[model samples]
Target: MTTAAITEETKAGDANGATAREGRGDLLDQVSASPRPRVSASSSPSPSSPPRAEEIAVRVVGLVKRYADGTEANRGIDLEVGRGEIVSILGANGAGKTTFLRQLTTELRPTAGRVEVFGVDADREPRRAKGMMGVAPQEAGLFESLTVREHFELFARLKGLAKREARAAAAEVMCGLDLVREARRRVGALSGGQRRRILVGLALLGRPPLLVLDEPTTGLDPDSRRAVWQVIRRAVAAGATAILSTHYMEEAERLSDRVAVIAGGRLAAIGTLEELFARLDKTYRVTWRDEFGAERSNLFGTFAEARAFVARESLSEFSIARVSLEDVYFALAGRRLTDAGGAAGGTNVTGAAGAAGETRKEGAR
Candidate 1:
């Protein structure tokens, strides 16, 4: 969408005053209620399964975003997400993950390229595109004075549900997000973790066909994080598509059907965990402390090789195992997992190089 067009829409929405949120809410309800092609399990296979003919939930072509100050947040990025799939985006703090998502959510306009949500042009028909999506931004305001139940009910009603239906929907979402115990408490009285769960619950309302979550479990504890994962898995199992960005490697590895790594304002790599792991020649890793107590790690092509090296080194404190998702991420992102949100320079061995190679292979085919 053009900047001027977005500005005009914002102005119009503001002009509507208190009714604007309600209007948008109603639009969501209408969109969710409309009949569309169903995504069968056979048609929309999971990442672990073979590909089949399925609807595309999201498509981006040569997407780019350049700020007024000349900072390029996204550059010539292209991606496609299948219906009912969960695609996790991983990147450093300034790597443009949020910028990519905001464009998909129509909250930000791209400087170049196209974004389509469920076949609707996101740039040209943002409202129609958004009607099919539920978004939980990294940060958003909440009504502190309102109770949790009130927040859900009010938002549900706005989404086009009748009073009773809204109530039931709110209750269901609360249960799924493990917020039922706090339903009667004011949002202001809740803990940060509780509030974060509420934000995630808000997106699950009405079971929207698509969900865009940015650090949805950021403040939650381990148990709460797992609950949110369950909620996401349940939604996808019921044929919902999700695109989320998270810092947790476990979250990305466990929940995502595929992973996308972004670096320096560009997509560095995109593939399933197995597909990504296949790119590495050294599939086994061994870690140990040297005789002087310094830590060391070695990679080998096979487990036997790693074990043989361990014996040859007479390593007493050491571990040998197959490479993990974190290894793949480090390889592709060219940085340690902990350094994910750090400064923008690393090995440059993965990401851009890997993605370019994949692009070349596709072109050749």
Candidate 2:
């Protein structure tokens, strides 16, 4: 589809008045009374025994994307998202997160792969696959002249809701995303953050079984981010599945049932936080400053080793804490979550998390 046409199709939607906590009848119920698809297993099964087609909300195998310039944006990517689950994709710029999602959404054709959504072959039947999904691309435009309510109602109708049903869905989304107060305001008058929320609300219009959000919380402040999180959680609770890509570590840590780390155009690791942490030999991290005052960090196999190193070094300013998803990302992607810089504050230890019970001196490998 042309850019203009795509925008018109997805441009308009709702925004919450204050927060999703506004207590309007459960947004899900007001939007769709039908039951959400459910999987017999709560999560995707091990790769050795993949979940049945019906139990899978989304499935991709050997997904590859190559541009005409000979750049392979996505290479051999494979993933499975179970129904009623939330999966977060993490990666730095150019890591192919967007490329991967675009292929899944069928906006970009893959060089080689199979993508299925709820048992439908997306590669073969893009329309049928898209009908079962609510997609919020990383970037989409909203109509400047349209009011918030108009955006929501019109999009709901376009998604096949009747006039009355569209109006109800619009109101529910407006209140749920804190856009009620701006119901009549033109999209041109809204702030960027508010505009972003409106885009999110658009995806929630018909309550499609799958929600694909690419950095839905990109520009919002903390509270707004949390509000969006709540909205997504409610949607999932009501039986929708969500797959989102985000740069925020905390978002991935708190919002996802499973996290997939995309590095160098491939999926480097995929698992729960605990499962990822267990992959690290160094479970504890110590942060301190060298005599030169440059920040230094070291990973240890155990808390005892971390504490001992601090005491042995006669350090008065130091902290020892459990490694986090940030560490995991560093281990897998070789970059920090906050920026496209080398891992935070020192030599990257994700690959070599210090020898067991050994404390290396500052900058010493």
TM-scores of the candidates are 0.77, 0.80
How many clashing residue pairs are found in candidate 2? 7
TM-score between model 1 and native: 0.77
Off by over 4 Å in 1: 1-54, 290-295, 338-365
TM-score of predicted structure 2: 0.80
Writing each residue's lDDT as its tens digit, candidate 1 over 1-365 gives: 21111010011111222421223333322322332222211211123433333578898899999999998999888888899888999887778899999999999999999998888899999988888888999999889999999999999887778999989989999998888989999999999999999998888888889999998888789888878887887788788999999988767776777888887778878777555555555555565554555544565665577667666766566666555556556656655444555433323323231211110011110
Model 2 root mean square deviation, Cα atoms: 12.1
Best by lDDT: 2
Instruction: Give me the runs in candidate 2 sitting further than 4 Å from their true place.
Output: 1-50, 291-294, 338-347, 350-365
Q: After superposition, how far is residue 53 of candidate 2 from its true place, in Å?
A: 3.4
Q: Evaluate all candidate structures by whole-model CA lDDT and list the values in order.
A: 0.72, 0.75
> What's the C-alpha lDDT at position 75 in model 1?
87
User: lDDT tens digits, residues 95-191, model 2?
Assistant: 8899999898999999999999998999899999999888888899999999999999999999889999999999988888889999999999999
Model 1 residue-pair collision total: 1
